[model samples]
Target: MSSAREPKAPTRPTSRDYRLTMYRTRHDAAVRRLAASLRGMPADIPVRLAKPGSNLFRFGGRDRRPGLPVDGLDTVLSIDVDARTAEVGGLITYERLVAATLPHELMPTVVPQLKTITLGGAVAGLGIESTSFRAGMPHEAVREMDVLTGSGDVVTVCPGDDLFECFPNSYGTLGYAVRLVIELAPTMPTVALRHVRYVTGRELFDGLAEHVDDPEVDFCDGVSFTPCESYVTLGRFTIEPGPTSDYTGQSIYYRSIRRRDTDRLTVADYLWRWDTDWFWCSAAFGVQNRHLRRFWPVPLRRSDVYRRLVALDRRIGLSRRIARARGQRREAVIQDVEIPLAESASFLDAFSRHIPIRPVWICPLRSTTATTPPLYPLTSGTYVNFGFWATVGLADGQADDHHNRLVEQLVIDHGGHKSLYSTVHYDRSQFWRDYDESAYRQVKKRYDPTGRLPDLFDKVVGDNATR
Candidate 1:
């Protein structure tokens, strides 16, 4: 410790601050009635809806937000999952979809955290991590989309249509992702679990790069540790039957991707990666509650955060236990930003050098698109990218401010743009830097003549939607 006689200095809050994005905050009933009244046009306006709750946060990819109304986007659709596809209303969470589709042997290759996520939300903001190298991004799974545009009209776009590509990761800024026609994955009863430890970020990434090429490998990644010491490299892949299959050390058949299906690992051990389960209050087992509100959008970088994250991952459970005993929520600003696959290394370097490292994960965005073109964060041709975010405990806003500066510069350095984002308090000029103005001006002119969507999203990257 430094000399205590020195003056006390100021500190920053570890939490990512959120502006109750509810302007003119209306109840679900009123919003639904209003949305219902405004339906039947070619454009769809943005409105909050009601939901149960999930791990995927719209703002920070942490705790779930209150649900909202998405039924008004449909056209006499009565069911959830169809024969060839699922006509999921924007409201349904990823857990419900997975549960509904399991019987059909159809897996929605969305964010691995499927137990709680929205089909529309996932499509609007794409993510395909370990499985992405195999399946591509979430948008690729969409068969068709019924977008609720700002023009007060609902437009249906499919694979061959012009409006098909702008659907995913655009966030809610380009109106709501009212409905989706998602593709499915095959069913496998058991997954081979592999845990290999590494000492450094390079070793972990190299290991991951090596394992991704194997055919049986379903998902693989390097868990936090150091390049000089031990780290967990966990993987889940399809299990094949034969004489060799019987000789296994440890494996499990997980119902959902949330936790490791463990026949032997303790609850704490099983959920070593599922940190939220430990952070939240649950009486189910002796789980304690740490009350730090979880949600903050932080830019994701790959290389730099990998090792720092490993160290944090190891301590989350124990720290939460202590916090719960003390009756204080663990304050964490979970910032998650996705970049193109090629940018992962450079971005990660920026993060490790700039921000306090938290747990990070990699996701994928499809390379091919019919209408949506490539820019910076918005890449073209099938590609993969990862996200880096931090979960810290603080009381002042300095941590958040730091995140802002890092992300702001990151955007410029990476030559990228964010789509349909939930900005904290940035200016229009910063947003405009990511997305251009020409396409947005034309589209704004045609649809929202009063200029509503731009306040939510900067501008469009294409001319087809505007026309």
Candidate 2:
């Protein structure tokens, strides 16, 4: 050109760039508000989170203390498609996170079975899924996290940090995760399933061990209807277009395992298959009944909805009254325990003989790294997670915690550990022995020296804690 043209104006940000910037700004403001709230809290009272819902089965009187306001903390801030990473707010549920990531053809390394489970809650507590045998637990996928410590400081902790190492299974005693950078894995458009039936527990566990290290299998878990009737379901990702089954409607997922030897589902449906019927626990509320299933709204068919109904029953003692009227004494025996693969059969045999609950869920897991997280210790090897949720009739002479206590001792005897998400019956010494007390104290001291949060033992064990 004959004349020098004026420099072009700076390029404007793209729509995605603008949205990401806005999300980050809102996240930062929310963090500041939470930190200020924590700092303003009186030293005498223990702290709690003002979350809308909880997946925890520990039911009791609600804490009267005002909780920290955590508004705007349940958002997905950014996603790096090329890097296969996502930075999400702590309170973001896996359901929402999946929605955000699926369009990019990616998903978290290990998506827990339930959709309502929060990213932060899964990290702070523990979460496992079918992919756990290869990818490990949810916390193992976190690249870094911003935790709001009890001292009112927001610290970005990575893998090597002591706080980060002990954060899982701490159950928020040290601090609460506000933002997390997590690794993601590519996903196919659909998943194909194969249900292999086994006649015995030994056969079931042996069949499971074979698939744990197989590169071809993308997902692995088993269901034991009884000692003699069990099925090891294996899932594989596929790109081939095919007609998929619909379990969200009247057809139940667990029942399908028993009926169908082969099935196919879209990636999203496969990840949340168990959530539709709450893994057969919906039977307690008559949702499994064909008559009632017709009337149950599809949108409300969620794990959280069933959990709320359970909470309401607990509040009014509806189940207790029903049992009393029937001249029966039943104890809720909801629990998940992990046993070394070699001893899984023995543990399951003992469980079948003692605990009457059936349709036990068995998921295999292995640590992604050689070094296990300190709080929830798992040596570098394969372990089987057994989950059973139902009420067992208590003998006239037995205590309410009889079955739970037996499960705890059985887990210890089998060289295993039990998850603390449900009712805990351990004394202080026993609980400390099962979990590394020394390691916990050191990390707790470092992150929360003033002890703004409740102690792990007191928080989890509740009234059962032996002072």
* Index of the highest-lDDT prediction: 2
Instruction: Provide TM-scores for the models.
Output: 0.61, 0.96
Candidate 2 lDDT over 371-438, as tens digits, reads 67777898728999999999999888998889999999999899899888888988889898888899
Clashes of 2: 0
- TM-score for candidate 2, residues paired by index: 0.96
lDDT of each: 0.44, 0.89
Compared with the true structure, what per-residue lDDT tens digits does model 1 show for residues 299-351?
A: 21111123234335434666567766876544333444555545545665676
Q: In candidate 1, where is summed lDDT lowest over 10 consecutive residues?
A: 1-10
lDDT of 2 at 432: 89
- Pairs that collide in candidate 2 are none
Return model 1's CA RMSD, one decimal: 15.7
